[model samples]
Target: MADRSPEVAEDVDVVVVGAGILGIYQLYRAREAGFTVRLLEQGNGVGGTWYWNRYPGCRFDSESYTYGYLFSEELWRDWEWSEEFAGQPETERYLNHVTDRFDLRRHIRFGSKVVAAVWDEESAGWTLNTEDGHIVRARHFVSTTGVLSVPQFPDVPGREDFAGEAYHTGLWPKEPVDFRGKRVAVIGTGSSGVQIAPAIADEVATLTVYQRTPSWATPLNNKPISAERQAELKAEFASIKETLEASNVGFLHEAHDRKTFEDTPEEREAFYEKIWRSPGFAKMTTNYTDMMLDDEANAEFCAFLEKKIRSLVDDEETADKLIPRNHAYGGLRPPFVTGYFEMFNKPHVELVSLREEPITRVTETGVETAKGLREYDIIVWATGFDFGTGALRRMGVTGTDGLELTEKWADGPITWIGVMASGFPNLFFPGGPHGAAGNNPRYGGTQVDFVTELLVHARDHGKRRIEVPRHAEEAWMTMIENFRQYSRFEEHGQYYGGNTAGKAKAFLLNPGGKPKMMEAIGEAVSSGYQGFLS
Candidate 1:
């Protein structure tokens, strides 16, 4: 609900929503292009996900440098990441530094969330009203609302009855959460759960981790960047940027050119071991090309993972439970972990399998299940989000046909290369649904650049209305969904809007990855932007 008593409407050429990494970049592009841009963010600060998700061990799985903006050579040389993988604090600080360094903070409206956005037929623009009284009219409305902004909590009985402190990893507090000598319970075995469990295991007096499903864990193997390596990276900034843009998955690491069957039995073992030792998403991305697609190849990798977990954890059953059996190795988003399996080996830590003893409710003290009520001083909900299109669906945006965005995307999201929806005139939803499938910022930046190009085209052509024709939207959606068949993401699960209850199970990503997306954009540009109707 917006506040009553509105202020005078502020007109701008563009209004970019969500002041995350992508939002800040959009602001910079619009400003530099001579457009009066105003960025509205719900949070008090710039770091959107990093600002909220401060849970312990929350960090970048991607290479720190590759994930950061490669637009500016000066920026690449100036900022030195402490480690190969950066934690929440470092990531947040870096984003804030970038924002301040680029002078993007002034154009940002902190604490203002866009609640309602309406397309104006007569004005050929958009009227955006924030949660507060502020109003803005803009020719272009770009939403970098982001894929994982909205957190989703599972349906558990008596959730509010718990008197102890509860926190969702997606919305962690600014202040430090004390787990020392306290009985702590973590729910879900997703990426966040995998990270936080090992992090707090030593500190908590008794740590009970409730798992609904198992997650395949790989070593992050993160190390501090040496001074010499930093200098080398700085010197090779141009090549690095070129490599990232040219990459299929937007990662620095290149996949093995060979297929699974190309190598002999012993050779496969050596390669699997190499991938196991590799950090972050390298296990999946740098593995044999057929590892993601072929059942036998994926199983071979999973066997190695199972063996690794068994070796790490003392208990065989616990180790088996830690390894995913139902899904493929790279099917669901696997957690690249640090001591995740070994956390269960700790004397104070315990694992609770929901399959064996299902959780009945959350009592005042802790979670209760078929076994009994386990008392905990604090409960951490590591449950994931309604990823991709969650935030945009909640914006209450009315499109050209006087239908809300929620309704437009009710069946599923339909967009032109994940940039613009058909009925949404002059509205751009970048970095939300149907965009990136990997290395978010890298893929997200490409979409932002496309939107910026569209705006530039509009300005040059003296056209205000920018709409994705229904035919274009349909064609794009069809292509991306077809692309999903070959992707690493599990066909089901949250990848297809299955995370949120009753949401349409539609593909929300461009699984053809960066190359295919760029191809689509190139086609649109070559055809004189005919896909977009004004």
Candidate 2:
């Protein structure tokens, strides 16, 4: 439901931005804490990413059962997911159901795009200004704007010259796109590109996928859950939730403590085959913990994956091009694809290596490459996003003493625990960088719970503000740097290492697992929230 108010409210205990999954939960927690909460969403409805990204074959990398909110048992018991990995429509439906079920729509102001958030020192609160010329003031400001909310268009020349229909996978159109007998060009080989290519291959007359760097992809043996399976899962929901909480990636799966090289060739191949056949991103996590840490261990897995790729694709050249050689195994966010590589076997599909023939510009009818030009009826930009800090920075957030978030994070984002930054009082970011790397929903819930506890403490003590101390912030930064120094993620030019521009940089993920993160949060809270000033 959209807000009926002609003007934005001036008096609210808490103002939540972005009606994404995190924002909805924040609203629930804030209201439960006996505070007047208002949620501002840029979109017409809920489900931030799901609402925007309506691309074909778009689905969660995490399993369906583990990707949802774990706060309510009633929701878990009532809702039944059809697939092991839920698609965009199902995810959107689930979020909408949650919103209506919890009566959260009354407080949500839809179609309200927040342009700027400025902290007023005198008022000791935040003044949020929207694009539609409305100002909202709140005692505490929480930004649940997702990491991948902002789409990053390529800096290619003459993109506007394309006369054909152009669409980005991140911001796909709601209406169905008819690709029958039409040539489609998909630029980028990330998760979105891999998924889109396979889905539209048969529909289009020709589907050309432009790849700069190939991503490692595992098979997703996605299938519908039977009534018996659903019942068994529901029965074990409590224990499953506990297992997910304790997991490093927030997914309940078997973890091999031994090194990859420790196993014989036959034993390793058998282990790899078993995991490869299993559904979802667990294939990357379940086997050999040292895959990301040790190059030798990573190489073994990479060889196995490369062999699999070669065997799957009919063309040797295509298979070789698809296999990732530059980065170590588990370096990039490996996507769980369904018939992605196999799509190349179809006569209509073609893989364009950007390294061999780089894109020169977008012509009037098609894309012009260094080698030549290729005609297409439709163009899809799967160019990915700025990620981590882009969404918040785009909103023009200003902290104490007019400290611009962009300027502060000019080099890179520096958060205490990816939850709160120093000098940003009564402000928190759930599922931000320096937090958990994978399974955002589970990690987000943990962060929200911690932030809620902090909010309650502040309210009980009559504290006007709460912020991370400068010393603690510095220590946290140092700790993150040290962790990056040890991890091999920094060696690869992937998004996890702040390498979106194809240049290796500092690692962004918290090196410690979920349990370690939870432990740190517990220690901080038990120590009278030692790092935080209330």
Candidate 3:
């Protein structure tokens, strides 16, 4: 399905830059709007993030049913998810199914990684140069290169010179990695580390997890969907679509209608215990509404989680290490797992807290800490990506009058609707900063739909270009910055583009979530796509 054209098309009305969920849909919408489109994908197949991050135990933190596209009810009902939290293999298969079902593969040119995109104002089109020596010219360019596309290695000495086989979870190899009977060391305890640690725990001779900070985690309680449950999902497709569209969090979990202290202490304990067993994001969505906003309420929940972790792990000291003391329960994005803490009880699995003894370097065989050197057959770098703007900045995109995208966004990105930035005519970057970040597909889909509509408007008005006016971009930036005070992630460095050194500390996610995004988009549409000059 992934084919590289020997004689590439000289021109197209729209050129989509990825083969992910957004890219696939963008192609469909563009073709429907009477535009010739070509989708460029770097990977050999569909599923951008899911296809690449195929490391052990990788799966959906969002519910399996909720994560799928809502473009068609027929598509939704036909495909079935095996579990509440679908694993990587199943998720990849689902995306492939969607691609083929919609007959989108023919339009996609896989292995076509866009290296540089230059805008020509005279022609009012973009000249895209791919990694494998192909030039695609198009009137419009839409970048669906997702937020987590770029893989970043830690700044540890001797990391590259390591003699052992090392792999970052984000860019895992296609062929199976051998771990059986081998000593494995996984660095970083974020979402990927939490999942892969327990998965390879029994396989490896010994598993050592290096932690910089302990993330507050809840149980996934993942389970197979019964035939009855599947039928119910199909039957509830309409309601599911409605709730997902209207939801701020992009999930269908029933929200609690009361504050944390509305119920007595014992009642609150019972409520916490009930949601503690619920699957995936239900822990956050269905919890007391005040859990995120109020400090006292979050403390109560964190206390309950601490006691629960203590109960699961046999070693008291090991259990204490797992509990996060600095950040509150919902301060940073919490990881949901099946046996992240329970794996520590396994005799072969050990916890290496970087705080007590920091890692000085990565040796030829393994990681070296202040305490001593620990050798391993493999070093799994579960370290995350350069987050929001990393992939786009690396693409060498130049806009009006030789303005590089990285240079324009050097301070921070300024987008009218989290998609179109000023001085970048006919170039829209979705699935990155300013677009909704947390629950990607649904929220990102919102911006995706807007871009399509704007394309239609441009075509109808006999316009060859579209750019957010400077005034509109300024107003949008103000709104995005104003909403920053409402976010729970002020201390969470990664969300603010603060994790990677030298990267601008800008809020990469929409602080207002879907509701506010929808509101501003509604105004733009009503005003005949206001402030869009062509």
Candidate 4:
């Protein structure tokens, strides 16, 4: 066992294991609630996702006004965003500014990656050890490790054989990559691939994009937010906050509230055209309520999008390859993109469908496929992350009876409202599994509020140990199973569950809408904190 001396181990009321936007807000709230809070971050700075994912053309799909903290009116009014969809650097700047404005840096220990956290039943607290051999003992442990923090590289043969410079979009280096006159090969067609391919198409002498699955992308009508519009939004910040809280997807877009089959072909085409012209993820919302639920309705939207794709691309075959046929529209997280499809029109750009000609291996020159080996100057892996529970699983946490969190979640993650596990006492997870599904920043604040309420309750009752009972956890899982019955997530292989690695499908996010999920959480709290034991 490591040293348990008071001098070596600092004790606090709460230890937050991340310094992202969620962790920042959580630390602030815990301090306000009279708890001595210490924050540990692996990165050199705050902005967990924004700090690492500095890929070219990386930006928020949600609107700027709806994607920030609603807790402080002063902060909201003071921080002005330049664009409707803020880029990676601007988002990072905003997060750093928030940390400075609130003076949160002093509480944060940079480069302190937590390696292990063990629950001490005798002391009724958690003992955490950092990678640098530093130890911390806290009454409460909170994990705000955002879902997309851990990047997953493609498990292709001979990945290390590539002689040229290789980079993953999730873990891009801080220095600017000069793609000028370089032959670039980008793999995967997720949001990052869609964003990166177009952004570098002009810069690179030759750009080759390898696609396994085609993403259904609507045009991001991204433009500068005028000074006048910024002022108006700042003035009505309260109303904006209210709208965000009440909405389903944690944005202000109002659904059309009609069925897709109700409208005529002309009317439907006109509505889709209007949505296509607008910015943000409004296309998913400003349509029939059953667009994601009903197959026939979803097909109509898919056909409409395919037609739009066909119109954008010069060649019919390329456009056909881009159209997603397997999954329904809005089935996976809808990627709002700009110039993704139009990039194919450039003479220097080339699209290789991996589904037709699967990648065989990575050679010293470049990627080798069934057709032949293609040489490149650089390779960009836009492959996604080990999302949902991967970030937390890597922390090496153990609870009662030496129950390892990794072992507990080996099959899949199970929790009561994605906040706490059955055996993990005094530990909270904000924005983890089974939580609200929506704009991450918006739901992040809601999660903070939920955990804070529980903390406050525990303090009021003089409770040092808190956890969900086994029965409660099982019951919650059952609730999640029932809710997912209506969702089409299982029909398609996506990351919604831990399905990327051929794992048994499980509902990772709460299938119920944000409003209903929040209501259920609130109701549970009002009912004497049902499901949780103190």
**lDDT of the candidates, in the order given:** 0.86, 0.84, 0.87, 0.84
lDDT tens digits by residue: candidate 3, 1-534: 434554554588899998877888888888888898889899999899898999999999999988889999999889999999999999999999988898888888888888999999999999998887778899999999888888888788889888989999999898999999999999988888899999989899999999988988999999999999999999999999999888888898888999999999999999999989998888988999999889999899999999999999999888878999778876667889988888999999999999898889987888899899999999999989898788888888999999999889988777776888888899987787888845788887888888888899988899887887788778778888898887777445678776687777787888877777788788788998766755
Q: After superposition, how far is residue 44 of candidate 1 from its true place, in Å?
A: 0.5
Q: 39 in model 3: Cα distance from truth in Å?
A: 0.8
Cα TM-score per model: 0.97, 0.96, 0.97, 0.96
Candidate 4 structure quality by residue, lDDT tens digits, 238-266: 89988888777888887787887788999
Q: What tens digits encode model 2's per-residue C-alpha lDDT throughout 1-22?
A: 5444647456798999988889
Candidate 4 clashes between residue pairs 3 or more apart in a chain or in different chains: none
Q: Tell me the spans in candidate 3 whose CA falls farther than 4 Å from its real position.
A: 1-9
Better-scoring candidate (lDDT), 1 or 4: 1
lDDT of 4 at 215: 73
- C-alpha positional error of residue 275 in candidate 3 after TM-score superposition, expressed in Å: 1.5
Mind sharing the TM-score for model 3?
Answer: 0.97
